[model samples]
Target: MNLTLKIWRQKDANAKGGIVTYQLGGVEPDMSFLEMLDVLNQDLIDKGEEPVVFDHDCREGICGTCSLQINGEPHGPDRLITTCQLHMRMFKDGDTIVIEPFRAKAFPVIKDLIVDRSSFERIQQAGGYVSVNTSGNTQDANAILVPKDKADTAFDAATCIGCGACVAACKNASAMLFTSAKVSQLALLPQGEVEADRRVLAMVEQMDKEGFGNCTNTGACEIECPKGISLENIARMNREYLRASTK
Candidate 1:
């Protein structure tokens, strides 16, 4: 199919960005959005022009690295999928697609469609892991019998890929949903109990320090999240934080 792509181009975080338009043809409907971008880049290279820069890894959607704002929506118009998982078939022939990077104060633009999401990594490093060591005296996971429902919820929360879509989707660019999901993933499991209080406090504090906005309960974060991370995780985190603050 023939199309027009209006993509953002910037030299770096300090560079002024604007939309640059290019026309292309023969985009297969089955091609993922990144593949379509690849075609466009190849065209640019063939013309001795610089290619657009975007972040992507494991295009299968597990890595959550291929993030783009398509037509004002994070990861395009598709639901429950990352930018790399979006297919070209979602568009029509002769369409004009607008693509930009996820915009947030914490996620400053690097170049073109790439943004520095290392803020997420910093937040994770703050308190997103279980500190327990099981190398030498490990007990079988099955020995600590977890309730099925709690286990399911924790697993659901763990699916968060830290894509920062939650922040991009929020009007205020809040990272509460992402931060809460990290907290809930640990809060529900007995293995994470030891660090529960400290984990929530540290993660939340770091999230704020990174310049992420507050959650006003708009719920856009969950709606745009590729993993469908629930608002309940935010609620659970609030409860956890309250309890932690008391201690």
Candidate 2:
């Protein structure tokens, strides 16, 4: 199939950016979205032109690095999948696809379709870990029994891949969903109970410092999340924060 792609192009974070259009032909329906971009880049390179740059590590959707705003939706129109997992068959022949990077104050474009999502790392560092004794006498993790429901919920929350889609999909560019998922994963587990108050407090504070907007209950974040992380996590986080603050 032949297609038209209107992609964002920026030299760097400070550079002025705009959409550049190119015609891509012979796109196989089985090709993943990133593979389609790869074909486009190869054509440009063969013609002595600069290629469009995008972030991608693992193409199987495990890594959230392959992020793109396709036709105004994060990771395209597909549900529960990252850009790397999106297939070209989702589009029709002669379709004009608009591709852009995830936009947010905390996710400034580094170039082309790549944005600096290091803000997520900073938030995670603030308190997304459980302090554990890693000495030679470390206890087996399975020794601690967690309630089945709580364990399931925590596992669901832990599936967040930090793709910044929550921020991109929000009208306010809020990172609440992502932040809440991180908080919930640890807050629900006994291993993370000791620092629960401190973890919630620090993580929320760091999220604010990262310039992410507040959650307004619009629910866009959860809807756009590739992992389908629940809005319930946000409510849980709010409760955690309130309890932490009162203490």
Candidate 3:
């Protein structure tokens, strides 16, 4: 298939950026979106031009590193898939595709189609880990009993991949869905019960300091999330925060 791509190109964080157009032919329907981009880059390199830079790793959709805003959608027009998992067949022959990096004040552009999502790592580092050590004092899994339902919910919340799709989808650039998922995952578990209150408070405080906006409950984040992380996690986080504050 022949296609036209309008991609945003930036040399660095301070460089002036703009949409640059390119035309390509022979885009196979079976090619993954990143594979198609690879073809484009090869062509550019062959022409003595710099290849387009985009983030990608573990293209199987686990790492959540391949993030691109395709035609105004977080991970293209797909329901629950990262940019690397997106296929060329999602577009028709002769389609004009606009590919851009995820945009948020906290996500600064690094180069063509690559944005610095280290903000997420910072927020995670703030309070996303369990405080307990399990080196030699690890307990048997069967020693503690956890309700099936609560365990299921906690597992669901733990599916978040920190892809920044939530922030890109939100009109407010809110990290609430991602941050709240991390909070809820631990808050719902017995092992996490020890520092639950402090965890929520610190994570939320760090999220705010990252310059992320407030969640307006537009529900865009859950809709675009590749893992299908629920909006319910946000509600759970709010409840946890309230309980923490009251204590």
RMSD in order of candidates: 1.1, 0.8, 1.0
What's the lDDT for residue 227 in model 1? 98
lDDT of predicted model 3: 0.92
Q: Write the per-residue lDDT of candidate 2 for residues 1-247, one digit (tens) a residue.
A: 9999999999888999999999999999999999999999999999999999999998988988889999999999999999999999999999999999999999989999999999999999999999888788999999999999999999999999999999999999999999999999999999999999999999999999999998999998888899999999999999999999998
TM-score of predicted model 1? 0.97
> What is the Cα-based lDDT of residue 28 in candidate 1?
99
- List TM-score per model, in order: 0.97, 0.98, 0.98
RMSD of 2: 0.8
Ranking by TM-score: 2, 3, 1
lDDT of 1 by residue, 1-247 (tens): 9999999999888999899999999999999999999999998999999999999999988988888989998999999999999999999999999988999999999898999999898888999998756689877778888999999999999999988899989999999999999999989999999898999999999999999998999988999999999999999999999999998
Q: Which runs of model 3 end up more than 4 angstroms from their true locations?
A: none
Question: Pairs clashing in candidate 2?
Answer: none
Highest-scoring model, lDDT: 2
Candidate with best TM-score: 2
Tens-digit per-residue lDDT, 43-82, candidate 3: 9999999999999999999998989999999999999899
Candidate 1 stretches with Cα past 4 Å from truth are none
Query: Number of clashes in every candidate structure?
Result: 0, 0, 0
Give lDDT per model, in order.
0.93, 0.95, 0.92
